[model samples]
Target: MSTPHCLRSSWHAAPANGGRRENGRVNDFDPTAYLPDDLLERIRERAPRHDRENTFPEADLDELRDAGYLAILVPAELGGAGLGLAEASALQQRLAGAAPATALAINMHLVWTGVAKVLSDRGVDALRFVQEGAVAGDVFGFGISEAGNDLVLFGSGTDAAPQADGGYAFTGTKIFTSLAPVWTQLGLHGLDTTSPDGPKMVYAFVPRSEESAGRIVTRDDWDTLGMRGTQSRTTELHCAVAPPERVARRIDPGPNPDPLVFGIFSVFELLLASVYTGIARRALDLAVAAAAKRTSKRTGKPYSQDPDIRWRIAGMALAYDALPPQLDALARDVDGLADHGTRWFSLLSGMKHRAVTAAKTIVDDAVLVAGGSSYFASNELGRLYRDVLAGLFHPSDPESAHSTVATAWLGPLED
Candidate 1:
């Protein structure tokens, strides 16, 4: 297919070296430089097409992989850019501004790579293979969510039967498995009650292979209101095998405050927040542009002159301004190894919930500012409205986030 005019213009202006690192070490790499305007514009142009077709953003993924984004978090010694979480959060926000579903789907891969970086920084080298794998062209997908498992990371519905070969066979159903179409490896956890250790939660990565037929089933049912390009489908694991070397960690069930748990939560929530914050930023910018260009028939002047329009844009900005710094600070803290103890969960979850809520509100206001034009399905704002809704379904949901914050403030309810 021919490139759209909007994308063609960007393609003509793209720089020769947009996303690659000049030196071997990119410790001081700028996040804004991670994705060029041309690349982002291309991703933006493709978003609606994928949304309309209800298909995965394979093109977007290909472009991102070509840009070496999947290896952004791997250490310099491990053949990666070696950038930190703060940098990655910035890049994610930028990516989300162009294509929310693309950003979200890629966030799954980033979460695992980010977790590997977090673990390596904290002296836990178990997930170093994740970084190495990414550099080696392996894509990781998060497969942690399950049906009726409110305990989240602290609990599991999958059964992990130990094998004499030191591997474990996972049997369970994982829902909302993003990157379903192209993930090379899936990071998941299950409970092994029959083990000698007695009921340990086993975390491992299962490689995707056609040779292992009937083990991993990726359902083609991913129809949704927004972020359709994510293709996050239901996955059924019929004794899916993870070799002994792929077993990342095993911890006691029920709130066992392990580093692996902390790393996953911190990276996942912060990166998730970054994506929504980017959405909010894009919505706010669109509102500004629409207001400046649109004219009100009554006044014969641009809507930018209208007091109501001005106030609405200001309100959107007010909500949007607080998130980036908060994300940066918290991400920096994680990179710096600052210890927040139990407060970390509350902070991470609260930030994610707030970003999602704020992005939704900003998108709503943007649609209002754009008038009825944005109401049409072809409008970017309309697509953003749908894409932002998926944030509510992610972990650290509104109710759970509030409960976590409340518990942090008042302590858990008496037994």
Candidate 2:
């Protein structure tokens, strides 16, 4: 497959580096730049339409894909820049700050791609799925959360079994599959339901053409107050699993997961933290901007100067400043872990819990500052509010995650 000429010449994914334009012309990327200001401005412009129309941020995703943002964490050996989890998490934070739903919806690709990159180290074909999607400009989203199964490690899940012919089929129902509407491939997680105790690996690759996975389904009436654009819906699967190459089983820490996986996961959590924080930051930014421009009815001054507003702003700022260092600490711990699991799992759980709470508090402050305007659908604060609220629901719900943490610290939830 030939690479696009536009990508070669007249295009730059980030202004940090001058690159060839889409017309196949070479340019120098500036080392000082992080993201092109034009790109940020463009995302902000599109955010309103996406928030109002309750539509997927197709334009933002397209730009992200074209700029190779989807492949940032992919290893250089596998045709990716090979950024670690810290960088990946920070990028997510920036994206979330601009548009919460858009950022959350797109992150499924990052998580799955990162997982695939790990699996790909075993062989090129194992990870070919990831590279193919990035090159094709298609972002793979997860349909992983099954209410029926209720297994805490993930959302709803079922199982896939190897067929008589050595291929497999996925037969399970999944719920809360955010971004299922636009996903090119489904990172459908399931237990090997065929197993008596469901003790086998069952990640299936189900194409979108399956009739059951029709463009959208509202079964179980999953209506989230926030993240309405996610269209996080439920679906039943009776699809054939394409056998490309055998992937590894994801075991619990007792079996001692690879340090690389543990390390990467530590980074992944921080990324999640950053993403929600970004939503909070954007909410605060909008609220402050709104407050600054509003004239008080009683005084001829900007309402942003009001004492209560100042307090809220201060709270938001504190959250903004505090989360990064916490995340960075976690990243360093994971990076330096000579022994994975049973050694660092407790600390990882603690950081995960702390980060999630800190981010939620930040969003709460931003919402408080915005007042009625934050509730208005026309306002960016409202959209950020919804996105941040939805953030609380995934990567393991707060309650279950809390239980997991306790079990790790004190030993055994069942006990």
Candidate 3:
């Protein structure tokens, strides 16, 4: 399939020398340049401290912002790297390998920018502010997840009261609000049941700076078993207002095929899958290192020489290898606007499911390969073991993924 005309403007592809246009200036597009080895080492060194103290990785965020990592998805004309979702996925995987919590937290911000990119490429410019905001160093928070609202994206439990000035006053609690401490703008959705066209699902962004005080509250209730650095605290909205210009979409609720809905799901799932895939890569690397270092007392040789140990590592590698290709392909599909129709949901969700489940399994085996020492709190593997579990809780979870895929394959179970 041919790529979209908008994407052909050098936003999705770079020259053979890896030169990309950033604000009309030619620059290298090397992933390592954006996230250098030294930077990743610094982030990796801080992961344990953040996890132990249950604190957010403020330094990581600062370094990432300084490196222009946050603007990777925005167009070059907007002073960003002008990369595609496929490139963004690869970068997220690399970032996650160094610090999963930081990657997960930043994922929320990227989701908004990514969705904007997706929409803009398709000629829907409603979310152009998201792209421009990202370029301007604005941090975005994902506030779509609400407590017990399983019909995500399709429905909202929060109330989006329409104001006379074409704005929305949102009132509800949003859970798992990542980047809670630093988000400058929050992209969220709520139900507007009292409008003339009642039952519209409203998508909007509320200012999170001091300018919008008292209307929004961020709860410091982020203590969790893993992914602690995400600081995904709960947020309370006391009629928080999204100004007229900030109101992005107000579509009919429940399974509608809106561009906003598709953009969010596609970007969110693909980037999410990328993070877990990175975790699996990290786990696999750790296992390989451990195997080569540990000696088998029975054979007086390194564990790497042991048949069973080698087999276990091979299994992990096999599982880890399958995900990146799928991520790259699907991400390219989204970037190129290849048609997938209704199957897009199933494919996206399935990719996320495969990534998380494989990451968990790979991490589990990694701990085993590293032996009892890995069980210690100081061991990185121990931290990873805890961090990988957070994947099960994200959207398109095991049950939901299976259900979506099953329904796509089998006609919605006679309903």
Q: Top model by lDDT, which number?
A: 3
Look at candidate 1 and tell me the lDDT of residue 264. Answer: 87
TM-score of 1: 0.93
Ranking by lDDT: 3, 1, 2
lDDT at 81, model 2:
55
- Candidate 3 lDDT over residue span 1-415, tens digit each: 0011111222233334344332211245467878999999999999999999999999999999999989998888889888888888988999999999999999999999999987777667899898889888899999999888888887888999999999999999999999999999999999999988788999999998676798999999999989999999999998999999999999887776667777888899999999999999999999999999999888899999999999999999999999988998899888876777557778888999899999999999999999999999999999999999999998887888887877777756673
Residue-level lDDT tens digits of model 1 in 176-290: 8999999999999999999878799999999999855699999999999999998999999999999999999998887755677777888999999999999999999999999
Candidate 2 on 1-415: residue-level lDDT in tens?
0001011111101222332112111144231133456776787788777666666677777777767787876656656656555556666777777666667777777777756543343232344666666656666766556664444333225656666655556667777676766676676655554545545555556556555344333354445666655566676666546354423344331222332233234444555666776776676677688778877778777878888778878877776787766665555433222233342444554555566667677766766766676777777766665666665555545665566566555766362
Candidate 3 clashes between residue pairs 3 or more apart in a chain or in different chains: none
Residue 200 error, candidate 3, Å: 0.6
Each model's lDDT: 0.86, 0.57, 0.87
TM-score between candidate 3 and the true structure:
0.93
lDDT of 3 at 124: 75
